[model samples]
Target: MNIGILSDIHIDREHPEPNRVIEGLVNVIEQRGVAIMIIAGDIANDYERTLHTLHLIEELTEIRCLFVPGNHDIWNEKHPDKTSWEIYEALKAFSGNLVNGPVALPNGWTVIGDIGWYDYSFGSSQYPIEQFDQMEIDDRVWQDKIKTDWGKSTIEMHRYFFGKLETQLSAHRSRKIILVTHVLPLSDFTVQRPNRMWRYLNAFLGSKQYGELALKYSVAYSISGHVHDRLQQQCQKTVFICNCLNYASQWIENDDPVSEIARAFKTIEI
Candidate 1:
């Protein structure tokens, strides 16, 4: 079976013609003969658009689609009455293929995933907790802190999801597991020796605990996207993949968004 993987589409941040971009992506997946497609997250910052995007993909393509929510996807800006967890619950109901639990594929692979929020573990030791807490001092105030209300600290939410992931991993111990998350799982995947700005921001990228869990469970393949840079690497028994079509502002010279989507949405045969 062939499975396609892509993430961080960020339709809200993309060019004006998002539907066209989606159509282009669908064509690429169809041409590749992909049976299933996994979108790691950040479909849109707006909840309704996220649902609309998923519905659009399902409506336009024959390939089965699976997804997990990104931090941006759960932002409660417009809906002040709802918490991040509440927003996640609503998203789960809307996303028929939300892979928070175990999903057995036709090819005998078990897929498991969650939003996988981060802890400050990825931050450099040079910086202290106070710095991360007071994000404005270093100009690192991410909108996630203000928009998302999980009713728990970042580390607490990370632990909560980690426990759920462990349960899924243990249940599917005998099968080849494909784990997915919206945030980076390993510090090794961070930009090599990041500058001062990136170093500080890395705190919100991901938690090393997720990588440790992947290793502990011996996952066959792990997928994630938050960082716009596309990368893949092998860590022991697991191959980690991050494929993202970030905002046009982040694109390098001569990089077309549609073409980049075609190049980044890799089809893996299992």
Candidate 2:
């Protein structure tokens, strides 16, 4: 089977409407003969819109669309009345959501996913966890601080997610695991820029504990997003991938939806 994987489309930020965004994705998925699509997250900022778009993809492409909700996807931006945890539960209940349980393939392969939270382990050594706890610096705040409220601390969420993921990985120890997370797992995938602020902000990018889990579980593929950069790296026995379409403003080369989708989209045999 050929699986299409990508993330961080941020439909609301990339386009004023979902039509063009949906069209772009469908084109790439069809052209590549994808049997299924795995979106790691950030399709849109609202849970309702994100769920709608996920369904729309399946409706148009006629294939299963499996996904993990991105940080942006769970934001109460549009659904302000709904708490982030409420939105989280909603995404988990969606039919195609991997969060409910593992999806098994015929070839002894299993796909497991979650909107994994972040720990400050990725922060620069210069700053203490206290600083990252502020979730702001230089008068700029991490959107999640405003758009999301996990109702728990970042590390608490991170540890909670880790426990759940570890359980899933343990049960599928004998199978080839395709672990999907909206936030990254390894610091190796962090942006390479020398921006000083990234030193503090990187804390929210992901957790090193996930990297450890990958190694401990002997995962075959680790897919993630949220950094808005395209990166692929081999660490030990696991292959990590992050491919994001990002916002239209970041489309420095060309803003054509189809073209950008093709550029960020990736397919792999399972």
Candidate 3:
């Protein structure tokens, strides 16, 4: 079946027109014989944007929209306590299926998806914070936080986030799984951006654990968004796609941006 995969639509600033992007995507799906649409996070960054997106979702009761939360959707700047659960609640209010782990679709295709963190190279010369070095510190903080469940708890943090990925993969064993995440497991897709933003996005959106998890499991493809620039790359045998939902960048990069990028939703048949 044909599915529309959309990501990185940062509708946080779109205000009353936030639904326009969703409607644009929906129209593309309707015309392209697409049976469903899978959004790989960053749909909206705030409550107002979420409400606007939800209002449109309420109108769209026919199509199946599967989504995983992106880092920005949960916690970007002001809202630090925002979890994936809160995002799910917001979407559920509009009858959308906010699947955290692996879930089997009505069409028999299983999906393993989550808002995964960025995977960093511990030994890379450019990397200042090594996972090995951080692990030692993380362990100490984790032990103390468990006594009181404070923000410094590494085990709790890992369990709450990365652990869900493992659980999801195990649950969907042997199935033809379409994995979705906001993080790029490998650094290939992220090499084009500025280092500081790259590091920040990587810490929150990309993870090697997620990559290894994908490789260990029966994943067909991994879709993601967070890096605003769009490109197609591969890690081992897996296809990694970063989708750009904004037309602004396309315009800046080209004189004929409309003809080049088209600012339209895409339908990738699997």
Candidate 4:
């Protein structure tokens, strides 16, 4: 089976029309001959755009698509009446294929995932809780704190989702497991030599415990996003991949919407 992976499309950031960007993405997926698509996260910033993107892909390609929400995807500022958990439920309803739990694919692979919020364990130990807490006053403060209502600390959410993943992996021990999340699972994938600001902000990248769990369960592959930088690394039997399209402003020369989408998406045969 050929599975296509992509993340952080951020359709709302695309210029002119988001529909055009979706058309390009569809074209690239068709061109790559991808039977199943795994979108790691950050498809869009809000609910409507996220649903629209998913609907367009399902309608146009009719390929089996599995996705987990990015932090941006659950942002609640636009819809203040709803909590982030409610928004997540709405997204799951919108995309019938959303993989918050384990799903057995016809290809004999088991897919399981969630938004996978972070626990600040990715940050340097030199920084105390006060330092991390004080980040709110600096530019490093993430919008997630204000936009989403997880009803628990980031660490609690991380442990909760990790528990769900552990249960799924245990249940499907004999099958090939493909774990997907919106945030990077390992600290190795984080930016290298990041500045003070970026270093402080790294707390939200993800938790080291995810990587540990992946290795413990011997997952075949772990796919994630959140860090815009691309990464591919092997930890024992598991392969971790982060393929992000990032924002238009971050794109460099010769980067068109279609090319960017194609470049960010990686096809793997399993």
Using TM-score as the measure, the top candidate is 2
How many clashes in each structure? 0, 0, 8, 0
lDDT of 3 by residue, 1-270 (tens): 887777776665433354455555556666677777777777665644654664565357366677776655655234445444454455555334444345576556787776665334412445455442253232233111122122333334434556777777787776777888776665666655545433433443355666677677747787877766677766666676777674344335543322222354566666
TM-score of 3: 0.73
Question: What's the candidate order when arranged by decreasing lDDT?
Answer: 2, 1, 4, 3
lDDT of each: 0.82, 0.87, 0.58, 0.82
TM-score of each: 0.95, 0.97, 0.73, 0.95
Please provide, for model 4 over 27-87, each residue's C-alpha lDDT reduced to its tens digit, 9 standing for 90 to 100.
Answer: 9888989888888879888887888888778789888788888999999878999988889
Per-residue lDDT over 1-270 for candidate 2, one digit per residue giving the tens place of the 0 to 100 score = 999988998888857655777898999989999998899999887888888888889999999988998899888878888999899898875788888888987689999989899988888889888888889999889999999978899889998989999999998999999999988898988866648888888889999888889888889899999999988988899999988888888887777777778888999898
Runs off by more than 4 Å, candidate 2 = none
lDDT tens per residue, model 1, 1-270: 888888898888856678667976888888988888888899888787888888889778966789988888999987889988788888875544454467788757888999898888887788888777665436557888799988787778889988888888898888999999899998877766888887888888888888888899889888999988788989999999888878867767734667767766787889
Per-residue error (Å), model 1, residue 123: 0.5
* Model 1 spans > 4 angstroms off: 254-256
- Clashing residue pairs in candidate 4 are none
1 versus 2: better TM-score goes to: 2
TM-score of 2: 0.97
lDDT of 1 at 230: 88
Which candidate achieves the best lDDT against the true structure?
2
